[model samples]
Target: LPDVRSQDGFRASLDAIIIMRSNLYTVGRLIEAVMNDNEEEAMDCVKQGADCNQVNKHGAGAIHYVFTDLYLHPPLDLLSKMVANGADVNLRDYEGDTALNLAIKKTSLRPDNTMYKVVDQLMQWGADPTQKDLDGNDALALAENRKYLDIVKLLKKQKTSLIVPPPHETPVPSPRYQKSTTPYESRSPITHSPSPVHPDWGTPVLPAIRSSDPLIAPDREESITSAIEDDNTDELDALLNDPHANLNVPNSMGLFPLHVAILRNNPVSRNDMVQQLLNKGADINVKAIPNEDHDEGGNTPLHMSAARDQLDTVRILLTYDPAISPTNNEGLTPYNYAEQNGNSEMMRLLKEEQRNAERSNKSSTCVIL
Candidate 1:
């Protein structure tokens, strides 16, 4: 008898056998043999012209089946054999996720060490690190999100250096004020007034003035004090600009200028003056008044703005220093005020600002807007 292994004998044997017309079944059987680690049978079938990269009816190729099974219960040697035998390592399934992507998705299911080995194997077999699936997530970003620090380092090492454009310069606004054609034209050049009283005036008045003696008091004294009390903002602005003026000076009730502004309920002017003072290095954490009312205690400008529903002022204050706590003398925070007042819009704004601060603190994170 002729040798059964000879080409002529093999052809005769094949001819005698009933050949199936279904390529799908043949592909399934090929995958099954490979998955079962029947290396001899798999190699023999492939050499007989079974397509190694053929997809089943579900659009899953040979490599996909290998990857799926490997991640669930990896057979490294068999996977290596399949890779060496020309399995397409980057073939995507119907979901448009490649073998490597699937491997990454399966990483959450495996122990760290095993996942590392699987990732290394995939990378070694030409898995593109930059490839993204239907979800627009690249392997590197996924790795970073998953806290796979070592894998991220490896991917970075393999990646080409990216050429990023230098950051665009933010244009500085012009100093010249654009004149508004409004009915109320600014009466004077935007100039800060001078300090109202001499520094010594606050020390101690002479006994003649201090004594409530009617004979020594001048006729215009009461009118002058009343005028000063009525429109004292210009004087406060002047004092705020004075480098020599005491920042912590209280106007009678032991309230600083900031406290006086708050009590006066002049939020717009108060905010402007407060910002000016802050720009000049005013402390934000100082209590405005030493003793106002035990219950209605002193607060920082942030506390005042939030309690009074001054959203714009609150935003401006936060922009200067978001770390400024919203806590008041009554032990309430800014977030507490927003919540208690049922101001949903203000609450949303404060939360967004908080998130921005958090993002700023995180390394390697980019804010789009």
Candidate 2:
């Protein structure tokens, strides 16, 4: 039948294969043991040829698991051991996130201030700061966005300075407006109105004839205006709906219904009232009724919204007409108002919208051409 020498050789070969498979299993168990925090067993397994750089199905190397999980805490001596034994420090996870980035994200909000240490360690170990996430945000940009001022400051200091050397001599542009040859002069002396005898009723007013032939006289002891004023939404609604209540009625200060609402400090109620009025077809672009005491500023709701930095209100008003610009008493537009208010976010949004509009105009022109 079979040759006796051939049978002996085949039996030896099978034994050798079994021993190799057993060694692989022992190596795998050692890695698992290390991950389980059994240091002695892990060392023995490592001695038996457990590859420290070996990754699981998810591409998470031994160091990745150590850094990302509770296998070992920082000071990272075990991590250093794995690294020294040939672990890939810069190995990426399934989402392409590096070990350092994941470490930072994990410890960013840690209560013990360990995040800074982790970040420092990463940086020292040559972690890339310029690497971008899926949203195109770099680490520095993300830190700034989340208001991590300290981290941002540190990162900025560590990075190469962006400052440029000033030119030796820069040319200045000539003034567009010509200077007046003659010295400026005051126009005229201002005259003051005669002082009133009584403070409450400053001046006597004549009864004016209405369209119904009724004379409207100033009433004595005008009701004290409360800061909360009145929530008289029902009355306002009725007046707004009424064909005869004169939607153009002005208060003593000559503030229109819309103007009064804008000037009020209570944003919540004022916004509600504004929305209600707008729902009843109130003119958002209505100019304030002019008064002798104060110029009504000719400010539309959009102008007021920008001045107050009410971004939501500004957005709503812009939806009606982004191009609408109500001039203030100083002849300043809403854009000017936004700049004066120091609303950088609002200013940026407005500028971006303006740029988009310009691009759209250019595209349309190209089509026409």
Predicted structure 1: clash tally: 0
lDDT (Cα, 0-100) at 358 in candidate 1 = 79
- Residue-level lDDT of model 1, residues 261-369, one tens digit each, is 4433344555666676567665565564443222235567666556555666777777776454456667777776666544577788878887877777784476667
lDDT by candidate, in order shown:
0.56, 0.55
- Superposed by TM-score, candidate 2 places the C-alpha of residue 265 at a distance from the truth, in angstroms, of 1.7
Model 1 regions more than 4 Å off: 1-26, 34-49, 69-71, 160-369
Query: Worst ten-residue run, lDDT, model 1?
Result: 183-192
lDDT of 2 by residue, 241-286 (tens): 6554333334444445665565444457667766765665557777
What TM-score goes with each of the models? 0.35, 0.36
- C-alpha RMSD by candidate, in order: 26.9, 25.2
